[model samples]
Target chain A: MGRTEIIEKVNTVFRDVFDDDRLLIGEQTTAADVDGWDSLKHISLIEAVEEAFDMRFTMLEINGMKNVGEMITIIEQRVV
Target chain B: MNYTELEKNCTRSTEGFVDSCTLAVLGTGATQHLAKAVKGYAYSEGIALDVYDADYNQIDAQVLDPNSELCHKSPEFTLFWLCTEKLYEEFCQSKQRSDFADTVIQRVERYWNLVNGKFRTNILQCNFLQLDDRVFGNYGNKTADSFIFQLRKLNCLLMEKCLAHRNVFLIDFCYLQEKYGIDALRDSRMYYVAKLPICTRMLPEAAKQVVDVIKAVRGKIKKCVILDLDNTLWGGVIGDDGIENIQIGELGIGHAFTEFQMWLKELGKRGILLAVCSKNEEAAAREPFEKHPEMVLRMEDFAMFVANWEDKASNINYIQRTLNIGMDSMVFLDDNPFERSLVKSMIPEITVPDLPQDPSQYLEYIKGLNLFETASYSEADRERTRQYQEEAGRAAQQCQFSDYGEYLKSLEMTAKTEAFDSFHFSRIAQLTQRSNQFNLRTVRYTEQEIAQLAGDERHLTRYFTLSDKFGDYGLISVAVLDKQEDKTLFISEWLMSCRVLKRGMEEFIMDELIRTARDNGFDTVVGEYLPTAKNKMVADLYSRMGMQPAGGGRFTVQVKDYAMHQTYIRRQ
Candidate 1:
């Protein structure tokens, strides 16, 4: 998937995880970006994305996602 | 919010919702109507019913008559052969069906298993065993102690067998019928007649009722019946008649309200939040409820109290706000139908249990109600009364300060917000499962899914705990904040305890959420409101906090312009 495609897939993950459609997809969306987005949901959405994109996130990298921008960067790095 | 996403969450993925049942009815009524109710309720929750057969005549005919078709229906049908009034014990002693006796006993054993099993559908009742027979009548020759022992053995053994694999239930219609007698059964709303015994009808609907009660028992029951004082608590209003003049104890209408109070209090003890929405001035109502020698409910028995000159609907609304419960969670009770009708028209969600015109049937009427059934009952149910009492105390303590902010500060309120850990996951999951009133989004969840959510970083689950000098509320609130973009927060679920409804804990949590978002350069926070009968308190929660409704009641509290309230000092 291209960058836009990746963002679209991640946005769908965001929309699905938070149950929101108008969820914006900037370069910096993070756990703090959405409502109903908390720790109990965070890991599953990541795992879902990891499975969806055939990518994996390490504990260090997973913890490293400080913002949406950081999440996209990490997912992008893994995708490549 | 998208309907498709909501559908996917509810239908496609059963991740966040635990089907928490509210009531578990145990009765032995069988009719098509009862059956339909049973089936419908079962689809919704869980049920436990009993089955009995009337007039050993059917069994008698089956047994003594050789022409009975089931006589030769395999050796298993030999039990049918023994169904005759004459052949029961004789068949037990006979060699005619000795070959099939073991298998038949094993099949009969299955009913016992289902009776004792979990996921019991409800009881299916047929008819009472004949008065002359061993199951119903005095085992004439047998000792009472031995009969009791035999009954225990029979019931438990049968429970083990019947509830064995099907997760079905067997109601003990025989027990109650024997205890209260058939006369009382005639008055029961649940029982219906199915056979030749005109007055003593067959509860043939037991099969279907079990299904309906089970389903009805599945979801949470939001509303509860709350009582008043003076004549409401005793025979006459204390203010009008004085304490000594108030009639109570085993006398006339005095005993009536006393009995009614006992019933209301009992419901409170059973996880129902009982509020006192009395029209009387505080001293009159509170005096009898508190100091009346014959009073059943103490001040601590009630969850919320609204005592002032106000319309009943307005008082109810205040109680709804104070409890952080929805209009549907409240069932208002007063002697006046005008007030009841007025409140009913004003707030349609608040249920009004029909008050008997005569005080004699109050106890019996309340007893017949199956409103309290639900899929799950934890220790929290027993503690609910205590919790609400404690919440009331906490609110009362907040009154000492002249300024609201000063009062909030004086409470030494500490709120801890964090990701779900093993310690709080079960309860966090429970909030998703049970919270109806203040919840922003009513998404129920299972423990396993909670664990899965904890393990997944893409979804974040956080719990909020509120405590002041009064007491710590443990983990009473939870919020599901998800990432939408770098700057947008999509709120999935937000709920605070009914105990701490007015404590501004939700606001504290929102403020913290926005602070977290702002600290990270987020611009806006999104929230949704999916209306349930019990959560209208938070319908305008976002709007009150500055977020306009996007559509319907769905809205967002933004971060950039929103100034976090400094009154609530965050511990986290």
Candidate 2:
């Protein structure tokens, strides 16, 4: 999957986890940008992203990601 | 079964919580995900719950303090989730490994007592899973005072303590560890980051165990197993492969089928009814049970065996009719995907698990389904299959007599009825929770509630067990009469097993109620028939039993004018 495809797929997961269908996630999108992306839902969002990408994310990798673009980059690396 | 799918399921909200119960989760680490997983599973089981997830590592404070949210919520169920990591930490700090077991047991007992003394809810606590330590390696089992050995011992002690206490239940962390490896169940990195003991990927599975307990207690248990014979109960077709050729014994691939039959047989002994719905010749189907030397399930084991060329769905319908149980209470297992799909599309209520391609996976697959869940078990459960089989015989006998009343009389049925006592309280409570079809005022009560009602003098509670030449239907009917003001007694609960429905038990119960009302110096007997989605069959039960409608689902009978309804069943 390319960067744009990964971004589109990742946005779907974000929209689902936040329960916001109109959610548009971009390179600069962070937890603060989503509606219900608190500490608890953040775990669920990361878990959902991992499942959607069919890969496991380490705690360091999950905590280190500052925005959606970095997470997508990591997902692309793992998918390859 | 991943967290993502579970989270999606959780998104489907069920509002305004009718049939609601409260649950409090007290864990050492992050437990909000557990609550979410539980809510998702609970909604699927038709339960709207109010779940309280205590703050991380506040199990002690929440359980001990009277001012805590748990005390205010007063949940009906309390779940204590302490992971093995916490126990291992405690073990590492202990001076003696042998003494660690006692310390752990004492600590658990303190929590159990504190919760039990403070609240009335049932506590579900986890048993510690021994950590995979290679320091002692495989030699840990041989060491009497090793940490692994003591942890194993501690688990046993915890189980014994739970069994001794009426309100405590054990969650088998070891079972989960075995199913999914310990590493999969735990994530050290996540634990350090978020204080979550169980990994998100594995939360749904663990949460399901707790949800199943809640379902069992709430009377959503599956009662019957509708099985397919060819390639399901055995390896191959009975028509093509003779009884000798069909693989079903204790050798090779046949062992899988044998083990599957054994599992089904054990379920039969545990009060789950078994029926055969097969598409095959009757003689060919009967051959395996009759001629095979190693057959575990005999012809007598099945309540109803439908062997014909009809479609699988129609056969299942026939089986449901013969057993007189709701379709939701039945599980149909077939090896062929087409047959399974046919049953699924036709009877959407029946649970049809997706069977694996290989026969060996059948047992494990069904075990994972957790179709048959029950909160309480008694001696009555063991005889459930036999009683159903006998009821089938009675049904067959009724065809011989032209008149239904005469047929009932010919059976020479006698009922042993008694007030709610120690011996039958558990079964009575089980029936009240599980019986949905014939239930009037379908009110579910826990064993604790049943015990209180049984002991109260103001309430007259009775359970009736019917027996005939065919066999015994153990504790088939329950009645709870509440005495109101002005010499009137109200029927708060009136439910009977569907198996004994058309056999004049209703009239017998009405007669018994009238007699009890007169004996208690009451002039009027009132009855109620509440409407629930599953209990439409008994909507007009009050009027059918000769009670005059008194408006608002209420009916009345003047005890002075009430004559004993003639019935075939005589009191023993």
Candidate 3:
């Protein structure tokens, strides 16, 4: 999958986990950019993303991600 | 349901729920998600759950302090989730590693006593998940001080304690870990990051385990399993394949069906009624259970058996009516998806599991669903099948005689009525919880309360047992009479087993009640009928027994004016 395609799929997962249909995401979107994206919900978001992308993020990778750009970078490196 | 779906369910409004329960959850780790899952799952089961989640790792503070939020809320049910990971940290720091389980059990007993002493609540404590740190590798099983050994010992200790304590029950967390592998049950990353013991993927299943216990305690239980015969109880269609050709015994696929029948037989022994509803000639369906040498289940094992060309839904409806149980308390199992869907569409209240295609996977799948969860069992449970079989015999003979009075006389029934004693306390309490349809006022009592009533001087208690030429209906009816001031005797409880209904049992009981009132020097006998969704059958019971309506669902009859009701049962 390309970076743009991964970003679009990731955005769908975010919308689902947050229970918001119109939740869109970009490369620079951080935790601050989303509502109800606290630490507890972050775990649900990670699980939903792993299920959607069919890949697992390492513990360090999960704890170190800074933005949607970093998440997409990990998915990009692992998907192809 | 998944974690996200359960989370979404929590947002739904429980606006019109008629039944609601209060629950308090305290755990040594993060339990907010678990509380949410339990509340959401209870909503699906039509129970509005009001959950009070204690702050993380406050089990001691909340249970010990009388003025804590837990004591103030005083939930009907309190859950203690003591995880193994937290216990392991304490185990590592303890100097006496060999006595770690002992120490923990002592503390657990203290907590139970403290909470139960403060208020009357059902305590649901989670057993430790059997996690092996693998420090001693395979040798951990034999090592006394190993974490795995101590953890398993702690689980066993919890079971023994729960068995001794009447109010304590265990959530089989170890069994859950065994069902879905430990890898799926626990997430190391999530545990470390969030202090959540159970993984997000497994939260719904854990919540289901909790809610199942609560449901059983609240008298919502499955009492019967309706089975399909052709491909369900055996390998092939018995009508097409003769009894000799059907796969049932020690063969390749036959072994699977045999094991399945064995499991059903075990459930039947455990007080669950079994009935066969099949679409075939009656002779053909009886051939295997009657003549086959390798069949595990016999004809005598079933409470009722119906084989005809009728549709499965209609046959199941007949079984439910004949058995006199609610449709919600029956489970139907069929290997054919078409038949399953038809029954499901027709009867929306019955539980019909989507059985797996492979015959080998049938038993495992059914076991995983845990359909037969129960809150109590007694010695009477083992004789249930025989009682139902006797009931069937009575039904068959009733058709032989045109007059019901002749049939009752032919049976020659005799009943033993005596004051409540120590020998039958367990069964008496079980009847108070189990009987619903014939119950005048549905009031549940625990064995402890029943014992207290038996010893109290102001109360008069009687337990009745019936036996005829066919068999014995042991401890079938219970009545508690409270002596009121002003020469009045109040009937606080009157409930009989549905199996003994319409057999002059109620008449016999009313005679005994009036006799007891006269012997005790009470002037008037009073009774009440409080209606429930299931107990409408006895709404006019007081009036039927010649008691005058005293308003507010109460009835009164002077002891001197009450004539003895005629009954076929001669007192023993």
| Top DockQ hit | 3
lDDT of 3 by residue, B351-381 (tens): 9999999999999999988888877789999
Candidate 3 or 1, higher TM-score:
3
Cα lDDT for residue B546, candidate 1: 72
Which portions of model 3 miss their true places by more than 4 Å? A26-33, B452-459, B482-489
Rank candidates by lDDT, best first: 3, 2, 1
TM-score of each model, paired residue for residue = 0.54, 0.92, 0.95
Residue B120 alpha-carbon offset, candidate 3, angstroms: 1.1
- Model 3 residue B209 CA deviation (Å) reads 0.8
How many steric overlaps are in each model, in order?
126, 0, 0
Better of 1 and 2 by lDDT: 2
> Candidate 2, B101: how far from true, in Å?
3.4
Error of 2 at B507 (Å): 2.4
What's the C-alpha lDDT at position A9 in model 3? 96
Q: In angstroms, how far off is A56's CA in candidate 2?
A: 4.9
Lowest summed lDDT window (length 10), candidate 2 chain B: B1-10
Cα lDDT of model 1 by residue, B208-270, tens digit: 233333433323455456665544556666668877788776677777877887777777776
> Candidate 2's error at B483, in angstroms?
3.3
Lowest lDDT 10-mer window, candidate 3 chain B?
A: B443-452
All models: lDDT?
A: 0.56, 0.84, 0.91
* DockQ of each model vs. true complex: 0.01, 0.55, 0.61
Query: TM-score-based ranking, best first?
Result: 3, 2, 1
Q: Which residue runs does candidate 1 get wrong by more than 4 Å?
A: A1-80, B1-218, B250-253, B307-310, B382-406, B416-430, B445-463, B479-494, B498-572
